[model samples]
Target chain A: MAESTEVKLLGLWPSTYALRARIALNIKQVNYAFLEENLGAKSELLLKSNPVHMKVPVLLHGDKPICESLIIVQYIDDVWTSGPSMPPSHPYDRAIARFWAAYIDEKWGPTTKAIDAVIVAGEGEEAKKAAVDKVYDILVLLEEAFKKCSKGKAFFGGDRMGYLDMAFGSCLGWLRFREKLHDIKLLDPAKTPQLVKWAERFCEHPAVVGVMPETEQLATIEYGKGLIAKVRGANPSKW
Target chain B: MAESTEVKLLGLWPSTYALRARIALNIKQVNYAFLEENLGAKSELLLKSNPVHMKVPVLLHGDKPICESLIIVQYIDDVWTSGPSMPPSHPYDRAIARFWAAYIDEKWGPTTKAIDAVIVAGEGEEAKKAAVDKVYDILVLLEEAFKKCSKGKAFFGGDRMGYLDMAFGSCLGWLRFREKLHDIKLLDPAKTPQLVKWAERFCEHPAVVGVMPETEQLATIEYGKGLIAKVRGANPSKW
Candidate 1:
């Protein structure tokens, strides 16, 4: 470990992005100091470190802050360098994985925004329907991604966990809980069977299983629910 | 040249993303075949190559297809194997560059979709107002990114023509057209003087200047105006 330096994770406990970083750290078997931040009352350290977004899963190497989970995961894979790698070999395969990873992050905003607006605040039908449609569209895209990326695999990287899986896998954790609490399953193993199957597989992995929130952890998601409700209420059309 | 392979670019000449890949190739001095696709009726080659997105700027290396402009630029940088790298030395700085890239991509959708829907179609007060707000917000974010990533640099990745600049520069080109068509001035040199200054510097680079569509090429974008209007009308609320 001659080249290794101290790696630290700056994150909130419940952030899906943060969870992705945690899972990557676990998979890479890299040691890190975890600093949890209250997203409401942002820490000076977090703000100074990631001033642009002023948010986390900021992975710090020495004093440098790597904001954005996907970038941080890539950093971990590249710098500390490890496990199965964030991207698979074969440039085409890697490109496919990157596409899905970005797609998930993009579509997640509106999809979940609509869900929370409906469940908590009960927003406009037009806005809600539009949001849900975006969600389903992304799911369809996800199904296609899984088909292409998962080539006889136990994971997205094929045979082992990769950075794309870590980014996507952690994000899905809240969906089932959201469905159960709201009485609507997004990935009905019946409809999006491939996506559901992928989730199931990810949940079983050694690194993922331990890092993921238990169903119980989601039961009292008061702050998260409130934030989503507020976000939707503030910008229904935007959602 | 043990790892050398044939390169080909499948892109629409007018597309903002396509310009990104073209600039990369021009700078790297990588020779490749260029196939301009009919976006309305996508070619079998483009569709087969990038089946998932089915979008343009699909750069195929040998047989491996790389979709998404930023991803394609990265693949080009990677496969070229040796060059003045697009991303700079520090991982944190690279993450900052990436965060800004993703932010612009995320924000551009809502802003451009809203504007293109109403402004181009020549329709609706409410939509127009909303579109204004969206674009304004993106400019603010760009302002901040320019402020944060600025290190007395010619581009977003600091000294070189990096991924973030390549990612945003496409829109910067379009922004000029948008201003001319809609009478909306974004990235105002006076307001976001830093970003506008950077764009000026980027445009001066001989490599960047060579590949980008000339003033005449952009003047003939009446077809693009129609296509964007159609897509925006179909999904007005998608933004």
Candidate 2:
């Protein structure tokens, strides 16, 4: 990585999207200034940088604020030439990486949101069961992708951690946090053994160890506590 | 580009997403077998290629299936080492291109869907008015981005018709067609002169000319006709 490149990351501490950028930066060994944003009272810099989305995980390379987590991750990989590259050099390989990374961005949002809403904040049993089924369906698709697409490699980016790995790895802890908080296990060992193993490897990866916040700490945060309260507030009769 | 490469695109004739892929291939001068998919009844290849989305605009390069329009466009640019690159060579430039291209993809869907449901398929005047306001808001954002980001350049991808240009260029015609069919003029010259000029330039660009389907032809298609019927069927008092 080029030294003296002034890099700053504006992020919400527990955000998976923000985590994606952080993990990418850590993997690349790029030194960056981290600004934790109060999403409730978003900063002016955040609004100006994004303008379109006004969301965080916005990367400030000097004055250019790169919005979107996955986009920022790609930007990081491209700008920083050291460490293992995120996407493979081959065009086709890059496409595959882009495809799965995009998939992670697209799928993770709705899948987790459904789980959060119906399982964490839901009022009834039927909705929770339906949400569980929906989440499981998403997990099954991912599990199959890992089985078939990984080609027996440890990570989606191949033997080493890459863009796809970072994309999922950032959220893996959040998934666990949700599971522990809500007492619901979506990534069952038998059903998604490959993903579970990948999760283990991702959690233990040196690049991610210091970067990723602990689940217990995350669970105690305002966002996580809110989710816990929602889960607990569900009708006792349904339970 | 690369000759003798077995490139095939599974696409819907009138889909803007599919159009994005087609225009990219055309720009690259890659010989692709365009398999028109009946979105009403998608083909097996389409299903197999994109089991997750089960949508059109799936590119099959040899045996590998690349799904998602923007991703496919990037893949085409990467795989075929000829013509102008979709993303610029500089990392920051590439990031900007990727950011805008993504912005177009994310914004276009909901904006058009709102227009389709309210101004076209709507039964009330108030709803139609509200939808028009919403659509205008989306257009204004794009207009602002073009004015500020492009820096008086011809396209979003800078001076040349790059990835961001292709991303928006592919869908620009659809917006025009919708405007004409629905009798609403959102892309007014006065309100969005830069985008209006860019649209004309996009339509006339050699890279896009042969690839883009005629607006008249597009308006006569089953999908286009359905939209027209909805608009016409809407309360005349609103008109």
Candidate 3:
């Protein structure tokens, strides 16, 4: 029946958002066709499927398209019920999971983008340090969340991987790659041991290993050059 | 029995985000004690409850504080089974409701903030016109969403007041007030008939009237003066 129902994912290869949905599907053990999008030349299917955002990754399940990577992950968990639940069963726990997921999407993304600007822009040394400090403050906030909520478990979702873990997992590769590129570790082992450990366990997990791109693959010199150029073009003042 | 459960709402009177939660609780017919917050002198409860955003409206249900307006709205709906479901029952429909809610929170808020900057910032006449045009474009996208998903219903969730309706409803009073303040009708009758109609229906909604602040109240000269000062203070460059 699962095979009979068509499940397809429209995504760009390098997108952290797309990787999030892939990780969820991996956990759910659902068979899905993956269509890589050429972001520069968006396909007709991609445009039609997600006209609002016109961006990947879009999940097409039985012909109905669900946009937004986190939403898609939730949808996969809801529809394919055979696997362990992605969000916890209890209502309050579910709300907590959703809350953190939102924080990751809303807060973490912008903070990282600000960090990216500082990294890519050819700025003064002091300015760069100040910018990096601002990002560290944001990281500290997440570290606090992990400490308060994780309940001393191996993952944010406890012993098994759940939505919060996947939410952060989606960004792990990009975070690690950027850290290496900048030669500064944002998720410092000494400062944020729990998150570092969580990242290590997540990357090595069988469910994630099959889908996540290698840190080296994402941290290429070519990628850094392209990112710097794009960031420079977007915010010329900083550069 | 409801009163005994210790239901409370921490909110600011001028805040549309806070108003969203009040409207939801009003819709659910839940009896909640309203604790008006002094944002400048944030109460210990407000700080303790929502340290992340430290903003209202925070819903205290049986001593558990749920932060974020939309999240609080959803929590009220989920917890209060006696009232009608705020979101649709079907999983896909629920996702659709959430998608639009996300749009309102993410896209609509920023667009309006940009519009606010042009209006209050003493920007050049041409710049103000261009900013208004951008807002109109954003409104058109929402109008398209209404056209596609609402299925010829009065509300986004169909016959009843659902999450999306309230999400927009919370902002409707402010939208109208701001339009009047700037002397530009964003929900122009000719262009956005549906949203205009939705706004009218929403205000008159019995479920909302008790909770929604009067348009005149929000449009007061004093209110406008305070807003101008606040906006100017936040974005000094624009002013």
Quantify all predictions' global Cα lDDT against the true fold: 0.74, 0.80, 0.78
lDDT winner among the candidates?
Answer: 2
- Writing each residue's lDDT as its tens digit, candidate 3 over B84-199 gives 68887666877787788888887777777677777667776788789888878877877876776677998887778888887777887777766755557898878888988888
lDDT of 2 at A10: 97
Which is the winner by DockQ between candidate 2 and candidate 3?
2
For candidate 2 chain A, the 10 contiguous residues with the lowest summed lDDT are A230-239
Model 1 over residues A1-239: C-alpha lDDT tens digits?
Answer: 31467777889777899998998888777788999888779888899888767888888787777888888887777666545567886666777788778777867766776667664556666665665666777787777677768776766788888867887888776876666544456786666788888888898888877678765576557764555346445553432
Superior by lDDT: candidate 1 or candidate 3: 3
Clashing residue pairs found in predicted model 3: none
Q: Who wins the DockQ comparison?
A: 2
- Which wins on TM-score, candidate 1 or candidate 3? 3
Where does the lowest 10-residue lDDT sum fall in candidate 3 chain B? Answer: B230-239
Looking only at chain A, give the TM-score of model 3 against the true structure.
0.89
Model 3 misplaced stretches (Cα beyond 4 Å) = A1-3, A227-239, B1-4, B121-126, B220-223, B227-239
Arranged by lDDT with the best first, the candidates are 2, 3, 1
Per-residue CA lDDT of model 3 for A130-239, tens digit only, reads 87777787677777767756778877777788888888888877787667555578988788788888888999988888678766666454565576455556653442
- Global lDDT of model 1: 0.74
DockQ of each: 0.50, 0.80, 0.52
Tell me what fraction of the real C-alpha contacts between chains A and B each candidate also makes: 0.69, 0.88, 0.41
